[model samples]
Target: MAVSCVRADPRLVEFNDIKIGHVYKKTVTLFQFTAASPAMVVVPGLLIPEKQEEVRDCLLIHVEDTETIKIPLLEFPKVCSLLVDSVLDFGCIAANNQVISKHHPITNKGTAPGAFQVQYSRDPLVTVSPCVESLQLAPPSG
Candidate 1:
């Protein structure tokens, strides 16, 4: 006798279906750089729990790389908490596979730049063009 099994790929899993406040582990990198050159590897042994607490480490690095260096990343359900300048309502969008475009701006009201990722949307019809964005603002000149 022969038997076969099928398993769903975790990589293909839709994280949006997860309930709020679910704890999960994700690997992140932190870099130590100089004004002259970039480093080969980021600082290691830095671990933090995915809770709603501010992790203050470096201000300069944050200003340089907003897509990185943020503490306690607001991924998963927390991503939904992102504050948009205004709500987007695409009522009765074109059908028959016709694409429509809407432009919006995201603000970073911090001393450092940050990253925002559009993992998934509640509406199947809604999608982001450049799924990920870096929220970088100019650093204070000394």
Candidate 2:
């Protein structure tokens, strides 16, 4: 029985600045040449975690009656960038027992999603809307 295997195309795949709640995809191709009546090839899949971290690994492809082939994979750490206004001015207000509101915007400028919270404030009168411990912001689209 004679059998041969070819290396995967694009031998290495790199994912850079991947963000949580976002999906990235890659494809690899493998070729085989054999004279045997029946041949089998196995390709493995990868599963990445949701947390932000760096990953370096490889995929193993098994070919019957042949040596295993290796394809390298690299994943960079997640990054989140945000931009906020320097100052927010509420202006002057009388003590007439009236409610006042102001709008503040936060923008995400990085490739990954980000979470933020208003942890501290000196004045008791100051408050933020949607007062949740964690607020999620999606990355900007290109």
Candidate 3:
């Protein structure tokens, strides 16, 4: 989604140069996640579980080439836990998705730039949305 800097919070920054709509000269894909499919792919070995969920049903954009690809994430609830378990418990399985988690600097432990440690903060951003704090979706285990 093309976002602008006009968002009330500066921390949630946006690109000023890019416009807020599909920018395709000839073959621009206006993907609408109007429906969910059962045969979606999960990428845990490639990325974090939480990160994988964010890209579900989201459209991807190649800034330079304008080559867009629709990323359809795991739709099944069972698949969600399994994919999440792989990443959160073991590792991630990224394929071609360009987005990533945070970037860990050279001094940090992770080998890659996006495998940074989770930084927590009690700042106003956390309080931006109420449901963000209230809803906790965890499966109960025996």
Among these predictions, the greatest lDDT belongs to 2
Q: Write the per-residue lDDT of candidate 3 for residues 30-64, one digit (tens) a residue.
A: 32332432232322212223321223343243322
- lDDT per residue for candidate 2 within 60-125, as digits (tens), equals 777554578788888887566767788877788775777778888777766666766666578788
The C-alpha local distance difference test score for the whole of candidate 2 amounts to 0.68
| lDDT for 89 (candidate 1) | 67
* Candidate maximizing TM-score: 2
Error of 2 at 74 (Å): 0.7
* Candidate 2 pairs with clashing backbones: none
lDDT, ranked from best to worst: 2, 1, 3
Least well predicted 10-residue stretch by lDDT in candidate 2? 36-45
lDDT of 2 at 82: 65
Off by over 4 Å in 3: 1-47, 50-55, 59-63, 79-142
Angstrom error of the Cα, residue 19, model 3: value is 38
Q: What residue pairs are clashing in model 1?
A: 66-113
Q: Model 3: number of clashes?
A: 7
In terms of lDDT, the poorest run of 10 residues in model 1 is 5-14
* Local distance difference test scores for all models: 0.45, 0.68, 0.27
